[model samples]
Target: MKDILEIRIHGRGGQGAKTASQFIVEAALDQGKYIKAFPEYGPERRGAPVAAFARISDKPIHTYAPITNPDIVLVIDNTLIGFVDVTKGLTNKGILIVNTCEESSKMKEKTKFKGNVYTVDATNISIKLLGKNLPNISMLGALVKIANNISLESLKNKIKEKFLKKIGEEKTEKTIESLIKGYDEVR
Candidate 1:
């Protein structure tokens, strides 16, 4: 990693934004990196807007609070954009990944974000691949590709190790395969 990277994730309550942040922390830790992942509690209800954060670095992390001025902002729910300023406090060199089917140019025009803005149909991809509206795994795939910290293979292995015990080896393998395919499709 070049420098300590701070990431914030925004999504509706049940969209797996919190889980995605935790997974990213686990994946980075698997690569021998230091990380902190936590969620900012909001109204405890489904469909409510929620936020989570992850900080990854080669050095020790001192901050455990919610991330403002994030270097990377992952928007897991397009609907949340209307309720939250996803780009607020973002660094000028920040990167924004949106889980929308919209074209990159269109999203850029809509948000007027003066940073790298990338879009992926993570919802559709997840539904098609996993038969569930699970966008977190696919969005993580896009994030790993765009962030370019660790190789996708390393992330995949970590994902397998984390998920296999819970989802079973066969489902884990299939999910990994879908993640790879989703990454390739977006990249």
Candidate 2:
């Protein structure tokens, strides 16, 4: 890995892409790394395409521009494949993680992506655990598996601190379950 790791997340407005970016930044910060996280949206409404970027490094990150070539790409919505060039500037050795029920090999074939690939049935996991289709929190688990820069324990703590009070106990527990499932099941 380089001194800096850049990640791009793709999803729709209601899928929690922005929140996932913030959680990643918080987890990286807990590891004493400097981080930046921000989101971009074509339309600031539910179901509109949204992209979030995060950069983590040992040193301070000076760049504020969008990441053109990311070290990792997280696709929260696989349907965006045909609508967006999700793999536009991924590095040759970049890691690609997708939230889908499809097999990783099938996803790679469908996207015509030729790098390291991982897939998790995050949507199904979320639906089973949270009674919804939100996969962002679960996707964080897969991110931790791929990045390894942040500890799952730290990430879970952050999640508790951020979501426990806001969403209450049961929902938060389900979200954590989704996260752990994502970590265990990604391939």
Candidate 3:
């Protein structure tokens, strides 16, 4: 990974993309890295297109805007590919993780993604494990596995700390379980 890691997350308004960025910011903070996580959007309603960004480094962060050339891009909504250029800002060595089963060759051919592209059925896993269609936790699991900057345990701890009270014990447990399942499934 670079000394400064930039991550961009894409999803619909209710899919937890912003939450994923916030969780990652917390996890990176736990790892002692300077980080900034924030969302960019025109509207703040569910089902609208939403994006969140996270920048992590050993030094201080000073900007909060849409990441235009991120090292990593996480796509929580596969359908958004048609409407949004999710891969537009990806760096040459950047990697893309999409919530789809599409083959790498296909994605590259379709999106012209010059860098590595990885896919996972995040929505399926989320629905199966959480009984809902939210992709944040699952995509976060996949992100952790691919990035390898933060341990799964660290993310688990953040989840507990971040969502325990908001979602309650049962939902939080299921969310963590879904994250683990996504981590395992991606590899």
Give me the candidate number with maximum TM-score: 2
lDDT of 3 by residue, 17-94 (tens): 888999998998998989988889577999888899999888887766557789999999888887899987787699
TM-scores for every predicted model: 0.92, 0.97, 0.92
Candidate whose lDDT is highest: 2
Q: List, residue by residue over 12-68, the lDDT tens digit for candidate 2.
A: 998899999999999889989899999985669998889999999999999888899
- Alpha-carbon local distance difference test for all models: 0.83, 0.91, 0.86
Error of 2 at 113 (Å): 1.0
Runs in model 1 deviating more than 4 A are none
Cα error, residue 72 of model 3, in Å, equals 0.4
- What C-alpha lDDT, on a 0 to 100 scale, does residue 69 get in candidate 3? 84
Superposition error at 93 for model 2 (Å): 0.4
Q: Cα deviation in Å at residue 176, candidate 2?
A: 0.8
If the candidates were sorted by their TM-score against the true structure, best first, what order would they fall in? 2, 1, 3
**Quality of model 3 by C-alpha lDDT:** 0.86
lDDT of 1 by residue, 37-64 (tens): 9898868678888898999998888866
